[model samples]
Target: MSKTINIGLVPFSCVKLAEADFKDRAAVYVVLCMKDNNEWTVLDAGQSCEVNASADAHPRNAMWKTHCPAGNIWIGTYPMPTAGYSKADRFAMERKLRRQYKPPCGKR
Candidate 1:
């Protein structure tokens, strides 16, 4: 069966990938909880679940395991990272954000 785990301390977090295997280089995802506001369910991939093992020809769309031995989990989502071409270009988006928002220098 599949397994899952809870990340410690971090309220809500994520790693946005503009280029992924499923989308046309325009997707955003959060692999961890950083806000602790929106609730999420058990992840389908991790150290406990062997989702990656099923990646053999027409495999499941998601990964379920990590290279590490810890009890971490993995998941994927669609329709995120904003909804524009700038969002797809991470560097350009960040630059635009900074220029438009103009946050305090040295911290973004």
Candidate 2:
């Protein structure tokens, strides 16, 4: 079973990523939530808009033991190379961030 973590307050800009106004075709995003000591930590991360379309996409409900509402979730969107960005590049970047942050909700 995946570990459950608290998704607390985050920046307003981060919350906007999940919104239609902020969603972009070429982007990578990381979902962040508050961890202990009041520090924001990565809860999950991904690089595709298609995968993010589902209700369980952000925190991946199947992996987590608890549920986090939309208000508790924040996304940090990274603009990708529009001209030549490839799937491999996106995957690599996601792996890099996952390695660094070790977000509990992300794939192992």
Per-residue error at 56 for model 2, in Å? 7.4
By lDDT, the best candidate is: 2
RMSD of each: 12.8, 7.8
| Tens-place lDDT digits, model 1, residues 24-74 | 333322232112443443222212111122222213222322321232333
lDDT of candidate model 2 versus the reference: 0.55
Clashing pairs in 1: 11-33, 11-34, 11-35, 12-33, 12-34, 12-35, 13-34, 45-64, 45-74, 46-64
Clashes of 2: 0
Please provide TM-scores, in order, for all candidate models, with all chains considered together.
0.23, 0.60
Off by over 4 Å in 2: 1-13, 16-20, 35-38, 49-71
Model 1 stretches astray by more than 4 angstroms: 1-21, 33-69, 80-85, 88-108
Error of 2 at 27 (Å): 1.4
Highest TM-score model number: 2
lDDT of 1: 0.29
Model 2 is weakest, by summed lDDT over 10 consecutive residues, at: 1-10
